[model samples]
Target chain A: MKLTVLYFAWVRERIGLPRETIETDAATVADLVEELRGREPRYELAFADLSALRVAVDQELADFDAPVRDVTEIAFFPPMTGG
Target chain B: MAVRVQQEDFDFGAEADAFAEGRADAGAVVTFTGLVRDRPDGGLREMEIEHYPAMTERAIAAIEAEAVSRWNLVDSLILHRYGRLRPGARIMMVATAAPHRADAFAAAEFLMDYLKSRAPFWKKEVTDAGAEWVAAQAEDEAALGRW
Candidate 1:
């Protein structure tokens, strides 16, 4: 499946991009993170601390173990500092 | 219910009046606005707010629905601005209306608390020194426990 991954705030800073597109067969967010981590050093560093990061699949917040097999988009970012 | 995410500034007084006008059943209306404040680490130049365009409006709408589900609210509005904002600029606001003051007030607080941690927006403080992303507060997450 093709996926559009988004990064916000510091995650975007570390990853050096706001959004990206890739094809993956990873079944869950954690699996995808590990896959990306293996592809480059920046990915490895940005995703090194899972506890420091938050994930949203298809725009709704979800856990690392959450399934992403059928999702089109996923976002990774630090905890929100909104209003 | 109204959920808006934009880069433009808003008029608080006008927004409050617009929410309450001609609504006889809503006896109480409450609005909370958050401003950019130069504080503990004060070298303040401006703050840049970043948010996920695909998710911000939906996320706030879900929060609005949650507030309505938990309280007896007549109507609700959430307005949040992104991009660069100087000190004292309005960053966001939430307004709630209900038949009683308690419900209105509680619903407004609840919306604020949830939006603080749950919304997709992220703030970066740009000071005279440098620019840095603002971290989320532990207390803000803890505040959710009350509801």
Candidate 2:
């Protein structure tokens, strides 16, 4: 499956890019995180603490354990400080 | 219901008036405006707000729908600005109209609470020392527990 992953705020700064396309067989958000972690140290550092981050699958907020099959987009960012 | 996410400032008076127009049944209209506060030292230069453009609209619309359902609101409005803004600039606004003051006020607060924690926007404050992304406070998340 091909997925478009987005990073925002400090996560984007740390990861050095805003978005990317990755081809993977990962079935869950966690699995995708592991795949990204194996790619390089920057991803490992950006994803160092999953608790400090949030995930959205297909633009809707989802848990890390959420399934990712057939999902086209995924975004990861720090806790929002909006309003 | 109206939800807007843009990089431009909005007129509060016009928005409030427009929200109440033709809604004679709504006896009360409550509005809350969020501003960019300067640092305590008074050296803040600007605030940069970043957001996921596509997701921001969808998220605010969902929040507005929840508020409408929970409070039976007559109408609701949410306008948030991104990009660079200086101190005293309006950051966002949430307005709610209802038959009574309680519902209007409550719905406005509920919208703000959800917007602060659930929305996709992130704020970074720039000061004379440096620029830093504003961290989400625990108190903001705790505020949602009351709802």
Per-residue alpha-carbon lDDT of candidate 1 for residues B1-147, written as tens digits (9 for 90 to 100): 999898999999999989999989898999999999986766789999999999999899999999999999999999999999999999999999999999999999999999999999999999877899998899999999999
- Per-model TM-score, in order, reads 0.98, 0.98
On a 0 to 100 scale, what is the lDDT of residue B4 in model 1?
88
lDDT of 1 by residue, A2-83 (tens): 9999999999999999999989999999999999999989999999999999999999999999998889999999999999
Q: CA lDDT of each candidate? A: 0.93, 0.94
How many residue pairs clash in all the candidates, one count each? 0, 0
Q: CAPRI band of model 2?
A: high
**Where does the lowest 10-residue lDDT sum fall in candidate 2 chain B?**
B15-24
Compute DockQ for each candidate against the true complex.
Answer: 0.95, 0.93
